[model samples]
Target: MWVLIFWVLVINFLSAQEKFTVKKIVFIGNEKTKKEVIARELSFGVGSQIDTSDLAYSENRVYGTGLFNRVKIWAERDSGDSSIVYVWVNERWYIWPFPILGWKDRDLKKMFYGAGLIHTNFRGRNEKLIFSFALGYDPWIEAEYLNPWVLGSKNLFYSVEVFYQRVKNRSKILEEEFGSFYERHLSFALTFGKRYGLYKRFWGSIGFKEISTTGEVPYMKTLSPSGRDQMFVFGGGFRYDTRDIPIYPSRGFLVSVGYKFNRLVNCDCFFLQGGLEFQGFKKIGIGLIASRFFILNSFGREIPVYSHFYFGYNERIRGYFNDVFEGENIFGGTVEYRIPFVKQKFFKWNKAPLEEFSILRFGVDLVLFGDFGNTWFNREKVLKLRYLSGCGVGINFILPYDLILSVGFARNDTGRGQFFIDFKGGFE
Candidate 1:
């Protein structure tokens, strides 16, 4: 009996070694990009034998670049040596455009139109350029441009961006007895940073921002009030990311710290402010995010508009609008589950579709959210704890554009519910 078991194990081991072998590799459709560059992105290479177990890992490495729409790998045996490996990739276009629409209250709605263009591998050097513009119904417009490059003879990456924005507040006669004043401002920022591998991966950047806004609103001018505030921001923060993707991080912690100098354009009080953010999760697929801000100065203190203490959209909870709760010292959190389904299969070259619009996916989440922050100074005393508890379901569609359109619905404890329909990037 012992001799029979030994003989069976030996035969199985020999068969496994004979099943997989690599001789050479050929890459097609990569002109401006170096073949070696693409080869390094793969988990398997020339002279290395391949197995079915390694296929998914190789596919993920290339698709993670956000530059390819489709990738296919094939193996052909060479009667001379061993087996020749062939890798074929279909690249996506560099430029794209889209529109945006969102809702809050029935009376207060928001709409925007925007487009962006990105160029990868420009001039045969692995550099990127991005340009975008947005215009909206709330009477606002913004434009920005970004350039990122890996520094000469170094692994360091740097980027520079310029932005301009203007907004006007319009009143609804039926919604309120009095009208609301508008806000207009102009601002500019400059940023620089480098990536490092510590206990985990991290990126740090230092930047400066200058913003000036007008104080005279139609209502403020008529109602005897102080006008306008101007602020200058100079600070630096480091971000630690363990997520697989930067744009849509599934697991990681993102923390930012900054200081701002706020001076009323023509007033007596000038203040200094500090901010912090904490975001991270466990791989069992649960995530958490929290942020806070504080101000200290010779004059009256001011909380930055970008600072929200607890409640809002995309921060602690979904199915809500941005900055829904205006206040100092806000906090929010979310719990989610991520489950994946589906396996890849091979087909004839011409018969295979360029993209899989939908890959099998399953996700369910329970959320408990609340805000204990307020916008006005000394208004913290009046801050009430508003809480909402709900559950949500999502459907994912994977496509050539790498965009995902998710339709979700949630019901709150208050008996009020919300239905959300939005694009989850990389699926649309």
Candidate 2:
């Protein structure tokens, strides 16, 4: 009787242990991101017996992708067959609507509203499509497209874009003119290249662009001589970038050279431009940028259209307006001190409300910038060496979506101050 009882207890314990083992996993609450992607990142998988000891590790794997806002796992016992494992996920919404505010100098000049829809993952493919529109108070619509891949390869890439924009400008001497203009632009580029060792990269591409415009003249009458003008450009260039990121590069160098034929069929003019960028650091980060441009008519005469150089803004100097200074030769540099400010993590993986990850990072940057450039119809006639300098403070926020947003204010040597905001993806 005692031996029989011991045998029965042993059988029951074995059955219970088998029941707790996981044979399969089922995923839910995924619409944009794919299940296969999440599965590959997970520590647990089908046919693997469930181990409560590794639950935390499993959760961390899923959260690292930044695709989910929440994730959950559970199991159910089956009466006849293998136990069923359930993986529950909550998806983050893919749409955002926000306001846009910008200023050229110090005035709160423009107020606009914008909306965007992003699909980081679509149809199990890691593809993204974004659509955005902005309506200025003057009521203009600007649209653009960013296609990271067309051939679907990491080495070869293509980007095609079309834009239509209209705006009213305030005349320099006369009163404001409600001048309306329509512009249609199309650009296509093909690139092939590779990244070398750490801190070295090179890529080259040939591109074509067409720009046509019809509108009244505002600010500059030369831009529209006949009240309507059109330009077609074809060019190819080689680009070498060593920067950590193209948008907000922390360190690296970039060099590009290109020649364009403007009004190819009509005006028959040639334009050449080249630029070099250097990002380096000793104790503080420093960025240096310089460019030169030349334009010549079919008859080999210099043209005024290509006689100007543009400087300022996030591209060259920080804490400045877009295209604030114009010349034929541009030289600009910025020095910044990057410092960590705060960091906080939230959205526990087990308690995640959606199939998304959480990230928190904060930093402060002190920056000093200088810009100098000259413009002339002839290269021989250029401004002497002089630079405009400014210094500022900034705050940075790094988010899970690989987004970096920065806000800053800087004052020039002339006592004029400017406030600016910038953002970039992939790198800070």
Q: Count the backbone clashes (under 3 Å) in each candidate.
A: 17, 17
Off by over 4 Å in 1: 1-28, 34-62, 71-88, 95-109, 114-117, 124-126, 138-147, 168-178, 197-228, 247-300, 304-323, 340-387, 424-428
- lDDT digits (tens) for residues 73-167 of candidate 2: 66677644556777666665554443555433222455555554555554544444555556754443333333333343243434344444443
Q: What's the CA error at residue 60 for candidate 1, in Å?
A: 3.4
lDDT for position 178 in model 1: 35
**Which runs in model 2 stand beyond 4 Å of their true positions?**
1-108, 122-126, 137-154, 167-225, 240-261, 281-309, 312-323, 343-353, 357-360, 365-380, 392-411, 414-428
Alpha-carbon deviation at 28 in model 2, angstroms:
17
By TM-score, who's the top model here? 1
Residue 240 CA error for candidate 1 (Å)? 2.2
TM-score of each: 0.60, 0.55
lDDT of each prediction vs. the true structure? Answer: 0.44, 0.45
lDDT of 1 at 248: 35
Q: Write the per-residue lDDT of candidate 1 for residues 307-402, one digit (tens) a residue.
A: 323344323234453324434444443433333333222233444443332222223222222222223233444345454444454444333334
